[model samples]
Structures are given as structure tokens and as C-alpha cells.
Target chain A: MRPRPPAMRTKRRYILARILPYGVQVDQKQMYFAVIEAATSLFGDAAVGLAQPAVVFCEGGYVVVRCRRGAENDIAVALATVTSVADERIALRTVATSGTIHALRRRMKPSRRHSGDEEVKIGETYFAVYRYPRQKVDLVEKGIKHQKSLFFTEADLEER
Target chain B: MKITDAGIRPYPAGDSTVARMALEAAGLGFDSAVAIGDAVHRPPGIEILRGAVIGAASVKEVLKRVRDPAVRRADIVYVDAGDTSFNRAVVSIKEVNVVRSIHAARRNAFDHVAARTAAEQGVAVDISMAPIIHLRGTKRQRALQRYADVLSLQRRYGFPLTISSGARSILGQRSVREIRGLCALFGMTGTEVTEALASVGWIAEPHRPVEVVK
Candidate 1:
């Protein structure tokens, strides 16, 4: 990421989206890099110059942006792209899945909140589904409370 | 921005477990997160089995015990545990400030008070963790149906929201997306969903995470 010119300070808004294929080979090592890439694209190429950019967790994924205010929607829309076999929740593909796809989603964690709602099944395969906050007042202000954790129990796992 | 009760207060954090974790966590890595817990003071009490559990007097007391200016960097992910060790730490859950219970969800049906509190304080509310709504006349094979009934109530009340595990263990953490869904499930929309997922949490931004100067 090349350093942004002084002129690039002007704040920009983006309504981002993701149409990544639901079933594909997603490597863990590359997942982080891919997330970083996805995040970098949100702020164009200038906001984070060549410093390798940064990641701010947003909606079950890392949001690489300079500011939090304008980037919320963009981040939300981008992360909605994360696909799983459960339900079509979040920006990610939240649908119940079996086989390898399920395995990957299980491993792709560092969840944000809604894990409580996500139920896991079988073996020791760990899948993270963050229980995100719901109101505008909560997200930008004090933040969501704890009782509303993603899941109500530790054993809660999405049924297969 | 919205504000809510952070359950924070002054406490005697002198040589405390949480206090040490809070200090060692800050800047040790830049990548941060935030989660507010219910500010509580365990008082010496006798349960038939446990015998003694302590309690606190007030929220302020809990905050006082927190010696560090900031609980921990709620945002700014760090790659390494030591700050200044690298240009930046690309961390996630490792960066957390165990403050008050930030995960408690308020009842959407009667959330006016909660919403107002959060707005006044400049914070997000955890509507997802609100007390489970008991459907007086509804019974089903699973909790989802019951949970769904509560969600509708939340939607109507406009409760603040958040994501969490209510995990009995301290090491557990949730993802931002999952957190967002938690809010959405309770009928959060527009800016609320985004705010909840990004709220300064265990995987949030940096110090003064909400330093917009609101």
C-alpha cells in the first residue's frame, strides 16, 4: 500500500457488496490475506498507502479502513459475504453445510459476536458465528451488553 | 452514538487478577477489542453449597478498582503481544478489556430507558443478551421457536444489541459478523447493526475506541 498523498484525506463513502461463490476452497492462511485485500479495496488504495494496511474487526471479519464512522455500512456489506452452511445471516453466507465447506467455516473464526446463536454439531469442529448487536444506539455508543452473547450457552451449536 | 450502562465503577484493583490482565493486555498488542460486563461487587454471601460469594456496592466502585486509565485497547489488532515490537499488532480476540458485561441484551419491548442511557453515555447496547422472553402460551420442540418469539419483542422495543457467548470461560470470544446477526435477530437495522458488530469489543479498534468526540 503506497502512502496516500496529502490530497487523499478527503473522506469517501462506499456501498460495498460481495458475490463470492458459496462453495470454494478457502485456505486459512490466505483467508487472512484475502480479508486484508478485501478490506484494502474498501478504502481504495490511498487511505492506507504501502504500509501493508490494517484490519479493524467488523461484522465477523476485519475491516481495513482509516476511519470507523463512514466505513460501517461498507464493512457490513462486505462481511455479509462470508458464507456458511447455517442460515443466510450476516454479510457472510450463513447456511448449514456439510463436508469440506462446513469444515472451513468451522475453522475460519476470530468471530465478532453472534456465536451464541450459532450451534455446532459433531466431533470437535469449531465454527464461530458472532452474535452482533442490533441497534444503532448500541453499536456506536456504549456497545452491546453481555447477556445477549451470540449464544446463550457454550454447547450451543447450529444443528446439521 | 448511543449510550448504555457500562457497568463500570471505581474499585480496588490493587493486585487483582483482572487488573493485571488489563495492564498486560494494553499496547502489549495494538489490535484490540471491547466488551462491557455487568459491573458487580461480589459480597460475602452463603449459598447452600458455595458458602461465600461477594458483591459490590455501586458501579462507581468497580470503576475505581480499575487502576489503568483504559481497560485495554478494544480495537487496533496486534500481530505480536508486545507493542512497539512491530509497526502494529494484527491481533483479534487476544486484545480485550474485561470491563462490565457489555453482552447483556435489553428488552426491546421496554428499551426506551436503555436506549436513552446508551445515547447519553455514548455507547452501544447489547440487546441480544437481554433476558429470555418467556412465551406464556408457547411451547415447541426447540428453543429456536421460543427464541424467535422473544426476537419479535426485541424488534418492537428497539433494544440495543451485541454478540457474545455467555461462555462460562473467560477465553471465549465471538466474531464481528456473528455479533451483527445477534443484533439483527433482535430486529436491529440501519446503523445499529453495524455499530454493534464494530463496537469496541474483544476484537474492536483502539483506545478511546469511540473517540469521535461526540
Candidate 2:
């Protein structure tokens, strides 16, 4: 079967969003499930089915979601409701939206972890701290799976 | 107008410290945030107003709670909304600044009488984004319904409204743009959301009649 003509193809819009908690790894399929669930739950199946939201890109702590042109705002709103992906507690922060993935990609400033592999112990548990720009520090518990993260600052770590 | 997140819990009660949350809030387009506890670490560039939440069974309990040293020093005092009679009575109290958790209250708990009283007393109602962002199914739907009811009453009675992230962590806090979209789900217009974002400042420093200083 041949593909549809260019004029008959659906015009799409892509939304750029950053996955919060800084370093949580989310699969593309998981991200799509999260977006679809959020959109469907918020707007119902009829609307989400019409919008056809899809996660086109998920990498470097950022995700680019594609949807029908007229439904970007609704999809963006739905993205804000996404509190987790693949059972991991996280947030999706909308960065920008565009007609092309290139424009949205331009807005993606992937956060780079600063050079710091420090360890801090609070009570009996130990946490590995990852530092970022603007004095933001994220401490992930040292574990093979299901690690707890504590968000802190330099001052907070110093105080303890 | 100052764009403020009405409430955020940091440090001991939450994973993130006040300083870090404030830093994140600044980047998220917030001018200030009401930290709802004793936050000694104050970061520059953004204002952090101390807030006290009073959960009381009676008006007498609320009155007594407001006299505590912590509550006295707080820049804002929030009362957990109760039943209809309690709500009507709580808003009229001089010490109460905001009535929060209305979503948890019964449908008739914050009716027209409470709205009129809140308006006359300059007491604001808080709309928390947590329920919409975190809760699902019936709970979230109930929260949205409560917010819509509050918005209707607010419009009719000319009462001030405040929007709080109700965030316990940095991830829970949302940008102002996201807030506008979330609020739109409950039928709140952009202008209304802006005013709600700025309502805290108004409650903290309400306009007063000029007096002669002879």
C-alpha cells in the first residue's frame, strides 16, 4: 500500500518537556504510555483518540511529544499532569512547542551533572549526591533498584 | 503584581530544602513562595514568607491556635476548611488569612454565606494544584468541582483567591505557565489565575484608608 499524499497527512505539533528529578531514565514506550494515560484521563478517550498523542523522542532527560496541530495546548496541559513514568515518581516540565522537532530540539538545554560524586549518610541509609548548576544538589540512594532521591542544596548539606 | 506560589513545604517535612525550592521557584516564574514552616535558610532574589496552617475542630480552637508564637510570627495564617458552620465562622475571625483544603470539605461547606463573610473579612480561599496534578479519578474530579464552586463564589462575592502549588518537593512545583493551563481545566480564566497568584500580597498588606498624622 502507498502512503497518503502530503496534503492529506495530518499536520502535527511537537511539545518539548524535561523529565524532572534530573536523572531518571524513562523508556520511550513508557513515556508514550504516561502521556496517553494522562491525556485520556484528563480529556477522555474521545478527545485523546482524536488528538493521537505520541512520544516521538525521549532522551537526555527530555521528551518530545507529537500530537495533532490543534491539540497541542490540551496535550501540553495533559503533560503537566504526568507525575510519573514507569512507576517512578517524576515530573514533565514543558519547555517549548513547535511545528517541527528541530525547533523544539533547539529549546532543549539538557542538564549536565556537575563533577561531584560525593556520598552523604543520613541515619542508616547512604545517598550519592549529584550536583548541578545553580547550587542544586540531588541525592540518590545507593541501590540497584527503586532508589529514593532527596533534593537538597549546598547549604542544606553543609548544615547537616 | 507579585506572582507567588501560595504554599510549599520544605526541609524536614519534605525532601527538598527551602533554599533549593526557592531557587527552583525563581526559575519557574515565581516571585515568592509561602514556606509553611520554620525555614531558617533564606535565599536572595525571591521572597519566602513564613506560613502557619491551623487545623482545628472548632472556632475556639482556631482562635487559640492563632495566638501561638509561630502563628503570630507567620506572614500568613491558613485554616483547614471544615463544615459549613465552621467555615462561616472561621472566615470572620480576624487572625485567619486563608481557608485551605476546601476540596476535602463537603460540597455545602463553603457556600454563599461563607463567601460573603470571607469577602468582607479579606480572607482568601486557596486552590491547591496538588490534587489536580497528583490525584486521579474521583478524587481529582471532586477537587476540580470544589475549585469551580469556589471560583464561582469568589466571582460573585468579590473575595480574593490564592493558588498554591501545595508542593512537598521540587518536582511537585510547577511553572506559572503550567499553572495557567491547569487552572483552565477548572474554568478559571487567565486574568483570574493572575489575580489569584497575586492575592497573597493583597492579604498580607491590604490597602488602608489614609489618615491625618497631626
Candidate 3:
């Protein structure tokens, strides 16, 4: 009898996440461990195994994680639950999810920068702000030589 | 589409100070946060609403406290769901804005009757993330299951639902998107999560005038 070919595997989904503190980079192994630990802690071992998560790529503050098709949300939740990587406090924000890497990469193009200076008031003091990213902001206070950082998001800027 | 965290306890009341906690919550992308403590100075660019969590052993005590001049003046009123009767009583009251920790009990806390009453009375149900973050092992599993059951009832009965961080400190707060993602585990869709977050605005002041008559 002829040898049978290996069974075809089910298709998977890839999630693109941007690690916070923008410049901090982590390796594939560390990223994979952090995700697995987070999923295990949140959903337990059986679900994590069922999700079949894998780190396909990790570099330049971005990570692509693959998981079983139906478990994309579970994996995304797990990724969000991760608060630390390599003993440092960090956050993984899901930028996009796709069925193929090409599409996800296209969707990950850099957003246009907002120019011109703005003023932000924190408590009783006011600071001159230069740039504000999704996680952190660059600000300069009066009479201060060094710039101070304040982390804020678009939702924080709304006046309710 | 204002994102609000309706259940945060600032320092002296909880863990971190009010200003620091609000700053962290704002940094996490919330437009407003209800500080469940005594009066605290508000932060710039963020709306800080005052609220109180009242836990009582009986219905009479809850009613008496709710009618008190000090308690009546709060922007939001959350009644702790301690027992089945208490839960039913709180949900049926039109003055009560939220029934907090409905899943804290070991088993299903509210039933179909309670759900219908809450929906009719315009009372919202809160699923606090605190217990899930604090509990472990089988206890955590049980809590999640209970939360799922409550969510199903909310879907069937059409009561307003709010998913809150129930955070005591700065580190405990999650971004609006993060909260929606976590809620996905409980079977809430993206639209449903947005609605729940938006529901906070209405539930905080359900009877407010939409526009001035004059």
C-alpha cells in the first residue's frame, strides 16, 4: 500500500499587536511565553491548548500571533491580559487581525503624524505638548530643562 | 461615544489617590470616570462623577439611606447585591442606578423575574471585573460562569449592562477597548460592548432633562 499524506490542517488567524513603550523590543520566545502564560491564567490550560497559539513573527515592537480560526477573540483577550514581558511592565495592543500576513502588514502602515504644538493641563500645572501617541505623550514644562512624558489615548482627550 | 469607567474607588476610599487614579484612567482612554468615594478634586479634561456604593443587610436600610439628603445628591447610586431579596428590591427601585456585583454569589444570583423588573425599572446591572481578577482556581471559574449566566439574562430581558473595572488602584484599570475584548470571553459582541459602555452615560443620570424647557 502507498503511504498516506499527512492530514491537512485547519486555517488559522494572525493577530498583529504593538508592544507599548514603543521602542522596547522582545524576542519571539519571550513573546510566545508571555502570551501562553496569559492565556493559561485567563482561560486555563485546556482552552489555551485548544486555541493552539503560535508566535509566527516578532520584531520592531510588533508581534504576529497565530491561533485556531475560531479562537481569535480568545487569543486577543489573552494578549491584552498580558501586563508584563521579561520582568518589565508592558502592554500589547492589538492593531489588527487578518487571515494572511500580507493583508495584516498592509493594515499596519504608520499613521500620519499630528503636527503643531498643543497645551495639556494636568492638575494645576500646564505643559507644552509636542506629540501624543496611542500610549504616551511628549511634553515640556516651563523652566524645566528635560521633557516629561504623559501617557494618554484619544479617548482621554474628549470633553464629556 | 464618551468612554467612562463607572466604578473606581480613589485613595483613602480604595488604593491610589483620586488625581493619580483619574490620570491613569484617562491615560487608559476613558473620557470620564466615576470615583466611588467622598468628594475629590476633578482632573482637567476628564469628567469625574461622584458616586457611592451602599451595602446594607436589609431593604429598609437601603431605602432609608437612599432617601437621605447626602445619598440622594450623588450622581450615581450603586446598591451592593448581597442577597437574592436584596437584589430584587434594589433592581425594582427606580432611584437605584446600578446593582453591583450581581455575580458575587456562588450560584446564579438574579432570576428571570428580577431581570424583567430591572429592565422595566430602568436599572442597570454591573458585572465588576474585580472578582475575576482577584479570585483563583475553581473560584474564578465559578465567578466567570455566574457572570455568563447574568449576561444571558441581560440579553433576554433587555436591561442595561455596564462592564466596569471595579479597579481599586491605577494598575487595575483597563482601557475601553481592553474591557470590550475581555467581555468577548463572556459572549458580548463589539456592538454590545459599545452599547454597554454608552449605557453608562444614561444610567448615571437616567432622568436628566434632555434640553431646557425655557
Candidate 4:
């Protein structure tokens, strides 16, 4: 069967969003489920079905969501409502929206660790520290699973 | 107008420090954040205003709580909303800047009377994005219903409305654009969100007639 002509094809819009906390690996399928759940709950099944939202790319701490052109705003709103993906607490900060994936890619700024990783102890618990620019520091309690995370600054660490 | 987050719990209350939250807030497009606890660090880029939360069963108790030195020293004061009569009485108090957590209050708790009193006393009702973002199913529905009711009352009575992220951690902090979107879930317009973000500034330093310094 021949594909539909370019003019007949459905117009699409892509939204780029940065996942907060800088470095949590996200499964694309799980991210899709999370997005669909949020959109359906907020806008109802009918509206979400019409919008046809899908997660096309989830990498480099950024995600590109594809949806119908007219539904980008509603979809972006739904993206903001996404609090977690696969039980991991997170936030999707919408960076930009465009007609093509290439345009959205230009907005992706890959997050890099600013300094060497280290360990610190407060009380009996130990935490692994990950440093970033702007004096931002993230501490993950040393554990095999469900580790508690703490957000602080360089000054906060010094005082501790 | 300075865009201010009406509520944030930093340091001992949460994992993030006040300075760290301030840094995140600056990147999220806020000029100031109201730290609702014992937060001492004052970050340079974004303003951190000391805030005190009063949870009381009676107006007399609220009055007593605000008199504490810590509460008195706070740049802003918030009260947890209670039932209808309690809400009406709390809004008229001069020291209270915002009535927060109205989403948890029962239906019609913040009625026309409370709105009018709040408007008259310059007390703003806080609309937090936490419920819309974090809650699901029946709880989220109830929160939306309450916010919608409050929005209608605010429109009719012309009372000031304030928007807060209610963030305890930097991960919970959202950008201004995201906040506008979350607020839209409850029928709030972009213009309304902007005004709500700026209402904290108004509450801090209300417009008044100038007096001669001489």
C-alpha cells in the first residue's frame, strides 16, 4: 500500500523537557505510561486519545514528546503533572516545543558532573555526593535499593 | 512585580537547604521564596523571606501564635485554613498574610463571606500546585473542586490569590511556566497565575498613601 501524501499526513509537534535531579535513567516505555496516565487523568480519556501523545526519545536527561500540533499546550501541561516515572520521584521541565525533532534537540543541554564524586557521613548514615555547577550538590544515601536522596549546596555541605 | 513562591520548607523540614532551594528557584524564574521554617541561609541571587505557619483551632490561638518572637520576625505569616467560621474570622486578622492549604478544607469552607473579609483585610488565599501535581484519583479531584470553588469566590469577591509550589525538595520545585500550566488545571488563566505569583509582594508591602518624612 502507498503511504499517504505529505499534505494528507497528520501534522505533529514535538516538546522537549528536562528531567530534574539531573541523572536518573528512565525507561522509555515506563515514561510513556507515566505520560499517558497523567494526561488521561487530567484531560480525560477522550481528549488524550485525540491528542495521541507519545514519548519518542528519552536520553541525555531530556525527553522529546510527540503529539498533534494543536494539542501541544495541553500535552505540555500534562507533562508538568508528571511527578514520577516508574516509582522514581522526578519532574519534567518543559524546555521547548517545535515542529521537528531536530529543532527540539538543539535545546537539549547535556548535564555534566562538575567535580569528583566523594563520600560524607552525617550521624551513622553515609552518603555519596555528586557535585554539579552552580554549587549544587546531590547526596544519595549509600544503599542497595530505595536510597534516600538529599539536595544541598557547597556551603551546606561545608557546614555539615 | 516580583514573582514569589508563597511557601517552601527547607533544611530541617526537608532534604534541601534554603540556599539550595533559592538557587533552584532562581533558575525556575522566581525572584523570591518564602521559607516557612527556621531557615537562616540567605542566598544572593534570589531573595529568601522568612515565613511562619500557624496551625490553630481557634482565632485566639492564632492570635497567640503570631505574637511569638519567631513569628513576629517573619516577613510573612500563613495560617492553615479550617472550617467556614474559622476561615471567615482568620481572614480579618491583620497579621496573617496568607491562608494556605485550603484544598484540605471542607467544601464551602472558604465562602463568599471569607473572600470578602480577606479582600477587605488584604489577606490572600493560597492556591498550591502540590495537589495538582502530586495527587491522583479522588484526592486530586477533590483538590480541583475546592480550587475551582475558591477561584469562583475570588472572582466574585475580588480577593487577592497567591500561588505556591509547596516544595520541600529541589526536585519538587517547578518553573514558572510549569506552574502556570498546573494552575490551569483548576480553570486559572495565565493572567490570573501571573497576578497570583505577584500577590506575595503586594502582601508584604501594600500600597499606601505617602507621609511627609520631615
* Candidate order, TM-score descending: 2, 4, 3, 1
Off by over 4 Å in 2: B211-214
Candidate 3, residue A2: Cα displacement in angstroms equals 22
Model 1, residue A88: distance off in Å is 27
Ordered from best to worst DockQ, the candidate numbers read: 2, 4, 3, 1
Kindly list the per-residue Cα lDDT of model 1 for residues B7-43, writing each as its tens digit: 1111121111222212222212212222233213221
Please, what are the lDDT tens digits per residue for candidate 4 over residues B147-200? Answer: 999999888988999889999988788899988878888889999999999989
True contacts kept of each: 0.00, 0.82, 0.11, 0.89
**Top lDDT model:** 2
Deviation (Å) of A90 in candidate 1: 22
Reference-based TM-score, model 2: 0.98
Alpha-carbon local distance difference test for all models: 0.29, 0.93, 0.74, 0.91
Kindly indicate the candidate among 1 and 2 with the higher DockQ.
2
Clashes in predicted model 1? 155
C-alpha lDDT (0 to 100) for residue A98 of candidate 3: 93
Instruction: List the TM values for chain B, per candidate.
Output: 0.33, 0.98, 0.92, 0.97
lDDT of 2 by residue, B92-183 (tens): 99999999999999997999999999999999999999999998999999999999999999889999999999999998999999999999
Residue lDDT tens for model 3, A22-75: 445587898889889888988889999999999999876688999999999888
lDDT per residue for candidate 1 within A76-141, as digits (tens), equals: 433332322122122233222222222434534443343234433323433333332321010111
Rank order (by lDDT, best first):
2, 4, 3, 1
Q: What lDDT does model 3 reach? A: 0.74
